[model samples]
Target chain A: MKLEMKDSPGQLVAALTPISEYGGNIIAVIHQREPESPSDTLGVQIVLEIAQERLDALVAAIKVQGVSILRLGEERLLYRQSVIMIGHLIHTDIGDTIGRIDATGFAEVAELNVHMPAIAEPSTALITIKATTRSEMGRALDILRSVAAEKGLLIVEPLAGAEA
Target chain B: MRVAVLGLGAVGKGLLRMLAAKPEIGLVLTAVADSSSACIDPAGLDPAAILDTKCVTGRCGPSGLTASDVIDSGAYDVLVELTPTNAVTGEPALTHIRSALERGKHVVTSNKGPIAADHAGLAALAEDAGVALRYEATVGGAIPVIHAIRDGLAGNRFSSITGVLNGTCNYILTRMDDEGLTYEQALAEARELGYAEADPTYDVRGIDAAIKLVILANTCWNLGVTLDDIAITGIDGLTVDALRLAADQDCTIRLIGEVVPAENLLRVAPRVLPRNHPLVIEGTLNAVMLSTDMAGEVTLMGKGAGSVETASALIGDLIAIRDRYVECG
Candidate 1:
């Protein structure tokens, strides 16, 4: 979020205090003084990690500190997993396969890299899924497994903890 | 220690060759038998002469004698069962092991059939008769993993066991990743290189790896699950594009057999793993990762199958039994 506040001592701390109280983890705070003109109000950008439900509370609390809110942006998806699928991907309704994850609002297919050699030959795809949480990622993989089983496709999941 | 051997196949011949070379090991070959014939001598039979006979006449001894005859009333203290495996029935080897155990004789075997069939029952039978029943050659040949679980890591509780138990499937997958070959091409290479069998269904279909998981689960956790309980997914239908896709992400696929006791999970499938993962061994080498409480995760890697490699496991078990139970003359 971007905020415009008084260019004075203790005002930066006042704006940051409400972020923590409302369950927001502050990642970065950019506050620079311009060399050409010294403005009465200072512009600051704060990047934070917080759940969507708490963002409204955080915004209201920061406003109470007499700071004007400029803008708010969010990157919701945090967890991810990748799996390879092999079979007749296109013929088996590829759009529906991706829509299955998208329908689950918490998770979605982030990318689908398909390799199609011939029409009759079975196509292979690598699908990467992104989810809001770890449990939701598991649920997304479970949905992928069912879709594979139904479409006679082979799903090769990455070994858990292999990356570690 | 007087010892009797059954089944003069590749493993048997390799064992006899090793025992013949190392006489100071104190394991006297008292009786040896091929499928159709048996040779018994209370004063210890000659392994060198018997191997020569098997090579020449295609029989270890006269056809009048058989393996069951030796198991019933043989001049031996240890019975080494090396018969062909019928994973379903665990046939004649099961009965042979039972008889030997009942007679207060130590039993060691390379046959997964009998052990995978009735491990607890045979162990109980051996306990009742006061003898050790060892089958180190059964899974992960020459790795000594059974000993690591049952004795070396005895007090530690194993949470799970994950491994590449089948060598043929590993060979095929490794080739596919290295050469960009199709499944058929890799399998053909495996057959030409002697890694795959003429009928590759058992290895390629994941049954071989699942059978090994059953043995490990029964030994480690006493789960009592069989091959039927394992969910198997083979590498037969896997495509080259799948391997390439995995490679794009700096990963590779292997036929992994996982046994999680707490979850009652026994699964064999092709799973993507980081290229440098501990279980991502190449060629026909076998690797097992045992997750234990006290010891953390311990991995064992070695030759999974070969004439001499499996014989080495049988020999280790034999020496273990000799040092613990037998009276050396």
Candidate 2:
């Protein structure tokens, strides 16, 4: 998150202490100062990890410290998995297939590299999906499996290790 | 110790050749039977002569006798059953192994049928008869996975057994991935190389791998899962584009059989794995990864099947029986 607080001695510490109180881990604190520009407020960038449920309270707590929130960029999806799907993808409404995963709210179809052979031949696609957690990724795959089964398509999942 | 070998197929012939070559092992063949004939010599039959006759005439012994006759003759200390697997019924091999166990004779088999069909029943019969029933050649040929679980990792609890248990599927996938061959093209190449059968349905359809997984799952965790319990998705209609897609990410596809007893999950499917993963071995080679409490992850790789490779497993079991059971008598 980026923050703009009043340029003062204890203002930086005041902006940082509430973060730890809310059980957030501050990974890095970037304080960039410009020698040319004279501004009353200081620009600070913070990168941290916190539980999703505590994020709202964390933002409110930081705002109460007289710091104006510049921008909050939280990566909602962290877990990624890739699968291969084969069948008549275009004929089966490919948009609807991707739409189902995006509709899950916790997961989204990130990328798809499709290979189409001759006309009417079965098409193959490599689909990458990102989810908020491991179980959410699994649920997304389950959704894809049901969709594939309905469309007479074959879904190839990973023999997952920690790396896969 | 006296031993009788049933069936004169490649596995049977390979066992005889090993016995003939290794006189130091001191395994005396008392009776030998092919599908059409049986030869018994309580004084100890000659292994080379049996193989020679089998090679020349395609029949190992005299006519008008079946494998059952040799089993009832009671002329051997251990019965090595190596008949072709009957995936559905377990067949004559099942009855032969049961008869031997009932008669207080040690039974060792490379056949997956009887063991997959009725492992618990046969083991109980062996225990009641005070004999040993060992089928090390069932799952991963020459890999000694069953023995490793029963002995080396005896106390460790396995959470899952995942592996490329079928060679025909692996071979086809390997060729397709390496050379960019279509499924039919790779299968044709596999058949030409004798790595696949004419029918190929049993292997390509994942039924062969499922049988092996069922045998291991029942043996290790005693899940009582049969072939039907497994959710099988074979490599029969796999697209070459799938392999290329996997390759785009430095990954490849394999027909993996996985058994996670904790999840009550048994499945055989084409699973994606990294190129360097232990289970991503190429060709007809078999690989197994056992996740256990004590050992962490144990990966075993070896030849899945060959006449001599499977014969090696039979010999190990035979020698084990000799040292532990036969010699005591």
Candidate 3:
């Protein structure tokens, strides 16, 4: 579960109480980005197992504790898709492009290898993305397409006969 | 509980001082050991030199005063190994560690050589003897990498573990890049600042990082890759100009130790990372990043090395082991 909560003292404990109250043992809690950073809110990703009927209660309990649930769903990204994006990747702000794809709930860019020939010329990027389902993979491709259009970069996604 | 310090070096002295401040822990320093008369002088030591009141144990000679001598003396329940890393000279310390484990006494160590060289053997012995052998200070100083991987992230499937494990080399390289200091000047500065050793080859040539990588690899992946399996490249060749170029491109050149298992092979290397990248921004501060299937990428950053910081790790492990023993009982 990916949760976005207020950067306050005891906020993490507040968010975690519901998990324990609902009989969920938290396996891991990963807080990405510093809490003091103004531009970025605290992104907490927790791994826990709960009964299917109690999961709704867990989410509701967390919401009652004042934690904003950004994305809460089953674990995805077990399957991976490797693609090569050939275009002016360097000139087109490749980091922003990659960030957009990662922001989508379905896919995460696992590995990115970029080759730059010259400062002004186009560069090619080899990106490997992990997704849960094929439909989610298609949505991620759409997000990447919009990012590419905005940045004036071309993307060669999902090589021939590699769809799963 | 009575505690006997095996060595009176920086780490051992720091442990004595920290134990003095924590009255709730109910620890008593019974004996202290060192090779020279320097151990006798407790003046100017922090925490008011509580160990000075304790018995001045005999010198750490080659043959006399074994680690078992201190353990068998019946004055301590825990053994803290703070001896310097020399396989031959430190063999006695390892012997003491094994004996303590065999006798079901908890052992905590800040010495990397003993843990890096004999982790599996010692772990097996500790398991067989039903004792705790905790070495959190061996890898990332006080960063809690070992416990974080072994306990915190126990449920995750760890895919890869990477980090900048050596602080001496990182400090020298960061100084050279940030201040345009020559290699000799940086080396001199690191030595003056007590970061680098006299020879400093182990840290500069990536051998130290290799040892840390091996520990993390064994802990996370159970791949059993030894120190020889690492493809180590240090920061000796990195120049200020090269660092500047990397920084100009929104990237930083750090001596990264990476272990990636893909295509049924384990690979380790030092690579350049983007400035926005977590490990690159982690700078001077030691950072270990574990990429797992569930958590994506998790990075932990803190002071990687220092006498007090590393000693604190050792003490934390000691406290944890003690608590576990109480709970078990």
Greater-TM-score candidate between 2 and 3: 2
- Candidate 2 per-residue lDDT, tens place, B1-329, comes to 99999988889989999999998888999999988999998999989999999889888888988898899999999999988899999988999999999999999999999999998899889999999999999988989999988998999989999999999999999999999999999999999999999999999999999999999999998788788899999998789999999998899999999998778789999989989899999899999999999999999999999999999999999999999987633
True contacts kept of 2: 0.76
Two-way DockQ contest, 1 vs 3, winner: 1
Off by over 4 Å in 2: A1-73, A162-164
In model 1, which runs have C-alpha deviations exceeding 4 angstroms? A1-74
lDDT of 3 at B124: 89
- lDDT score of residue A128 within candidate 3: 76
Using Cα atoms with residue i matched to residue i, what is each candidate's TM-score against the true structure? 0.87, 0.88, 0.61
lDDT of each: 0.91, 0.91, 0.69
Query: In terms of TM-score, which candidate is stronger, 1 or 3?
Result: 1
The docking category that best describes candidate 1 is medium
Model 3 chain A: lowest-lDDT 10 consecutive positions: A155-164
lDDT of 1 by residue, B1-329 (tens): 88999999999999999999999887899898888999999898889999999999999999999998898875898999999998899998999999999899999999999999999999999999999999999999999999999988999989999999999999989989999999999999889988898999999999999999999999998888888999999998799999999999999999999988777678999999999999999999998999999999999999999989999999999999989987677
| Clashing residue pairs for model 2 | none
> Chain A TM-scores, all candidates?
0.60, 0.59, 0.50
Number of the top candidate by DockQ? 2
